[model samples]
Target: MDASLEIRPAAAADAEAVAALLTDFNGEPVDGPTAARRLAALQGIETVLLALRDGAAVGLCSLRVVPFLSADHPYAEVTELYVAPEHRRQGIARRLMREAEALARAQGAPSVYLLTGFQNETAQAFYRSIGYGDYALAMRRRLI
Candidate 1:
């Protein structure tokens, strides 16, 4: 872990920075207020972790315990993982993943799952390096 970094539960007050960080990694602008509201709801009912460095928010990841309908185990879904561009390659994301896994286990999750676009080779490599395997197929429908 980075000496100056701290990984903790995300709070409503960190919304704007978290939203902006998401937008930056996602390549779009997100309405801070809307994002904040969503984050508030998730915080109340789920686990969303944030990475802070020197008291500034720089990374965020979402982990939710989701049940496997046909299986006996409930697994964790690592939804969004992001690190500020300046903080990349510094193990910030890796630390966040470790935190997420710990959180998942605490929530009684038997496994952790994640998905990435087929062309997102970089993210795929990262996930694989972190010991995630490709077991499920991710399908999506574009409503736009």
Candidate 2:
């Protein structure tokens, strides 16, 4: 672990760096201005954590602490987690996860969840190594 590494909540100003990390994670380009705007708009509705090493953004994790309409306690879902290829296996991802879980705990969330792509075996394995296992099947549809 790098002594200078810092992982903290993302601000609108950090959107560009966060976006770059997200884009790299998915191999999709993220628009800076748009992402910044979205970060501002989603302020309280979402949480995005940015990891920096020596003042350079290297990875990111985003999650949501969600309230349900019915009879269950609020829960958390780690929507994204990405560490730059060069930074993998450095304990950064695990540290980010620890912070995320702490935040979730502080928010009164009793459980955390995440879904990795079916083909992303590496990610699945990583999550499994962290004690996250398959829970339920998730299905989605395009309303449009």
Give me the candidate number with maximum TM-score: 2
Q: For all candidates, what are the clash counts? A: 0, 0
Q: After superposing candidate 1, which stretches have Cα over 4 Å from the reference?
A: none
**TM-score (all chains, Cα) for each model:** 0.90, 0.94
lDDT of 1 by residue, 1-144 (tens): 468999998877877888888888888888779778888777534677989999998998889886668777676888889998898999999999999999888877888888899999999999999898889888889999
Worst 10 residues of 2 by lDDT: 66-75
After the best TM-score superposition of candidate 2, give how far the Cα of residue 4 lies from its true spot, in angstroms: 1.5
Candidate 2 lDDT by residue in tens digits, 71-117:
37787889889999999999899998998999998988888899888
Clashes of 1: 0
- lDDT value, residue 31 of candidate 2: 80
User: After TM-score superposition, what is the CA distance of residue 60 in candidate 2 from its true location, in Å?
Assistant: 0.5
Itemize residue pairs with steric clashes in candidate 1. Answer: none
